[model samples]
Target: MENKGNSESTTTTTTTTSTAPSTESIGVAKDGCNSSRILNINVGIMGHVDSGKTSLAKVLSTSLSTAALDKSPASQERGITLDLGFSSFNVDVASHPLLSQRSEIANHYDRVQFTLVDCPGHASLIRTIIGGSQIIDMMFLVIDINKGIQTQTAEIDQIPQESRQSKIDTMSTKLRKVLEKTCFSQSPMVSVSANPGVVSEEANVNNNQQQQQQQPLQPSQPIGLNQMIDELCKFIEIPKRDDQGTFLFEFDHCFQIKGQGSVLTGTVLKGSIEINQTVQIPQLNLEKKIKSMQMFHKPVKKVVQGDRAGICVTQLDSKLLERGLLCTPKTVPLLNGAIISIEKVRFYKNLVKTNSHFHVTIGHTTTTAIVTFFGNKILDQSTPTTKEETGSIHQFNEKIEYSFMEYLEPTSLEYPVGSQFALIKFDHPVLCPLESVIIGSKLDVALDTSGCRIAFHGSLLQGIDASNRQILHDTLRIFKTKVKEGAVERVHSEDTLIGKNLFSKQTDLSSFIGNYLFGILLVSLSPLDYYLNLLLKRVDKKTFL
Candidate 1:
């Protein structure tokens, strides 16, 4: 069967010219090797299923990895990306108008490598899409030029060729409006066609037949590719990197090589790693020495934060690992539960109730957790109206007094403003670093529903180990209020009074004695089980009764 949804092939052309360097020299490594620095930035391609996301990635990429472009048999058979696909292309730093102006960067860096992360857009693969989003520095929301934005694009009457450009602009405007409620509100939208000349139904049929036969087909010239590249370089900002911090790597693909042991492909999240360096997989509690490392098939001595690379390690079973973290020994903690700073997604219409189960995604892992809502009195009084105010208020502080909440009020109500928090008890232990972003979703919600599945997003304030739960409880002041009512039976003496139904048989009378109750001092408790005598001081007997 032909996979009509597979992206058409494209040919990219590049030209190189040699030039003599000026007096300012590029940095060199200790070994005296000329180190031409290449900065890597991850860009995610996302949209609804069959929205031409994979097609766009294919057209832009110059180098493809083993995991790139629906390489899986299942994905190819389904004609959609089933997992994350990785590919990349390099752009000259001096070619960009903005980047060339920065003498400091242009002097040190030779090129910028844009790693395209192709995320599956199918509803059933939303978890995979979310995992892919975590690693990307930016995103491309692709829309099928013919059909525009859709949950799943179906066969429709083709639009007249003359009106296609106008349609693309209209779709871009609609996409911007939809993104206004999200963090990507300021993101730019670009219009491009990966396969510009394959618009006729007969050509599509022929391409599908060729794909079914597993034959390589000639690519049509792409449209707006240069413009897209220009837009990318202009808007892209180099993110701050922490190469000196603890080493952390998130592996999304692992496979065994017959004689080379196993190779793990992933992005470096923090710090740096070198060949022969020891790294531990905390989830499996396994440690292995890095036998070799490669960045897009080029051997590299070291890889720093934000770089996409594949590490080969000996004496490790690749089948035993799929997706997890590799970090410096003992760097990531195993969390049984966690207290997180939370904010409701305004688009989510449902109430977040206490003890409710949610699919909590931390880093690339998604696991079920029971959520308990809590907040300080400050939240009850006022709500933050803007992102700036919300960030300032919702920060977790142990000194702030908090009370248990039955449920988080919907955004429709004015009460759910200000700082909100949640104690998440995970069903399974997760290896997570401190301050990691946590996303809560109701994944069980029907995919057909128009409502947003993402209920909330937050950051981990504190992690709770199974053994250290008590310490957290004692450290944070979370209290519940209780009230009791009773009638004064009669005046027992000049300084005392008898109260009835005040203490139940199960109630600890001694606890009430010497304690303040509704501003009245409970001086003592009587021996009688059904009645208790309260010793009142500095009060008339008639008034006390």
Candidate 2:
């Protein structure tokens, strides 16, 4: 009986223990994690007329329609990207070895990921260039293989340089003010029994000296963010070396509807935007919600960097949003007046076209300004040109010029225009700083050694497409001469160029594109890449003229 009772008691105890959950038990867990963090980076392509800015972007973006089949008849007929187009392409972070590491991807993801913003190269759309530039992460800085650097190129490059420098200066000033206060408070102190003022002065000087000695020689080190910014700002002529997080792009077109509300179209330069995300109109300080987005007439849940999508906004009218007005995120940094350093600025036609004043096109808007020589004295107010004048003052009706250049995003503010840079201040606040530039002819300014070399080589190999073997053959010849050292040859061996088959020599392309398409075809029969590859192969097989 005792043995039977023990067995029953043990079984009951075991059952109770198994049935009851432990106090430490958390719950069933999930394997995968979802992230709210997003990288929004904007890229812009600027080049002189017929430089293939549109062609380059068309091939890069996954969303935008190609030039041959684009909906607007004007775009197809004119062979130009009318207005502005926005598009997004996915970049695999793992494919790039540098970005594969956890720490690097976490830190330098924006620089590595590619998103392109396409802008019109015509001189008339300077306003659009400025406005569009505000949201970009880096610039492609495209030059037509044929046209080395033109007047438009100088103007385009100048705007971003000026805008970036201005922002750095503004941030630096703020930081310096903060540092001055901290430095004053942190200085060593001395107390004297008699003659307090005398002792204080002497002590203060000594304390300052001691403090200076204790401080690091490199001011680049941050006592705090403000102090670092202040030190950074002191380099008035240089571009700050810093990385910007988040993506933004500015739109050039705005239209209103009776029932549909306000709509705008352009590329997003920096950060991703979601439906219902509050968007700010910087020019007017008005905010609106992103009601809906349409990319190639299809709806998407969210739009991020490099996306060319049309946004329908709530609670805003077309009248409030104009051509030059900035369409940006509600919470982004406000870029304003810039004191920019410029490098290359040219004349409208030739270097000596005194009578020909050039129009500066930034973003989708254009402004008329007088062309003045680089070294000429800038008049404080608007002045008229003369027949025999060497330099002329060009003024716009509104203060749009200044604002466009200074409103560049913080990441890409490089040095000024000339080797001996010039400092220029815009008349008003530009909503988009990155896109603003000083417009002049391409021949006026002297090119830097590196820039000259690039120009010379590019000039030699104009009209050479990457797909053409003849172009590659010519490029190989130029490469041999320009790159004197044997080092370039080794680098060239590893260098991979994009192929015409869309199957660029990249492993990712072969794997993701080729293999993935094959797998999908087993189930679906037709995929975009499969058809594209088939078409490219057929084109390659054909005989040329």
Candidate 3:
């Protein structure tokens, strides 16, 4: 009886141990390797079409996501990136000279994961590039050494071996000139050949047997890759992260597994998310709890701001969500219109006028919006300052009064002369949060033109939801001045004068009382008598007649 009891106890103990979750299952081992914290930095790879952006991403990345390297059939067939591609590589924090110098960073982080965002370079796909640019911490403006600057170099070094150095220098100088007036003026430039001198398999097979035997084939290797990585490490700065704020994830891709559920792959724009937490898809008005989460294929219990992650949620239809926001319940508002603080892009030379339509891109969504320009009356009346003397405009202040502008005049390229605001009415409702970045562009322009299509960029100062749009227009203090001219036809009395063509019969003349016309104060106005009978405050009959 004692031997049987001992055997049962042993079996029960083994069963309990087997069922217990391991450290890796709970994500204690960071990145499934060690307990070191992994810091993620997003690097955007941007350039003109056929500029080797994808090749660079492929050579630098150690781990590829499901959507990386132009996996789409359309992309492979067309031989151009149709959408954004994502891939990543791990860098040793201790080994990096610049990162290791920072004691706090080196002590806290064991590895730095660089998530490369490969954006489409086609002119028609500029909208996608604009969306991808918003999420990047740093940018790589690749250039094809053979072809100097092109339309989309916003911001490659695949060149001949003999003249590679000279070509790189020339391209770098030209790039500096192009970026001199832009935000990326001081960004470093690196030259590299992602794929160097490799014959296709068909070409190798077609070679004669004697020639092949004389010259053995060798595998092609990337040139100057280490130098590019070094430049990136030195130029990248740790951006400020807000993990305590409300969780907001902007997903660019969505798909479903057989039984696991739907997976949302995107960068965490702000705050943090964890497994089993309930999240809301505000666009669809659907809520689902997170079943699991992964960062670069390694399971993690939590992901914070700036971290690229894949979140799995059950019972959610992947078809319903292509690219949109997922956040804490009731966090994002559905907006029909917005008031934004706008500044003209220096490269755009076209006039920005009121009532004009622009392609307004907010987050990953691009839609048409009609713009109405407004500025402070005092500032508009003041003497215009030179571009060099101007300063940045402050954000929209509700306490100050503003006057309607017919159009926006050219201002300093470096800074705005005064505070400017635009009332943007969207053609359709957009799901976005307040204070989101807004970019307005004229997308209908000819793509072949050698000019910038981006007109202006700013941040949302106020969001007008569908239900409160009318209330906002009535409450906001944006005014317009009007002038009415007329000649007196006759005089009825010393205090009254009859004028023609001043006010129509349908016009409400009650609001015109106490207004001045021809240096005479109007006490009252009656529009029902086929003309305006303006009752003067104090005037003689002879003065009017």
How many residue pairs clash in each candidate at the backbone level?
0, 60, 1
Give the per-residue Cα lDDT of candidate 1 at 399: 87
Give the per-residue lDDT digits (tens) of candidate 2, residues 1-545: 00000000010000000011111121111112133232434555655545445544443444442221133688779766554555544333344333344463445443222345666666654445555565554444444222234544322111121243343344334333433543222221111010001111122357456421222121111111122112211211212222244445466567776788887766655557778777777667777778888654566667655555678886686876645433454443333222222333211222223223333334444333332222222333332222133142232211222222211111111321111111222233334344234332222234331221100000001111224434433432111112111111111112221233433355353334322111111223456455544544444433221
In Å, residue 208's CA in model 3 sits off its true spot by 25
Highest TM-score scorer? 1
The superposed Cα distance between candidate 1 and the true structure at residue 197, in angstroms, equals: 2.0
Per-residue lDDT of model 3, residues 225-343, tens digit only: 56566666666677898889799999999999988999999999989989989999998899899999988788889999898999999988899888999899999998889998877
Candidate 1 TM-score, C-alpha based: 0.78
Measured against the true structure, the TM-scores of the candidates, in listed sequence, are: 0.78, 0.36, 0.77
Superposed by TM-score, candidate 3 places the C-alpha of residue 181 at a distance from the truth, in angstroms, of 2.8
Give the winner by lDDT: 3
- Evaluation by TM-score, superior candidate among 1 and 3: 1
Residue 506 of model 2: what lDDT? 52
Misplaced by over 4 Å in model 3 are 1-33, 152-159, 198-219, 377-395, 409-418, 483-545
What lDDT is reached at residue 214 by model 2?
Answer: 25
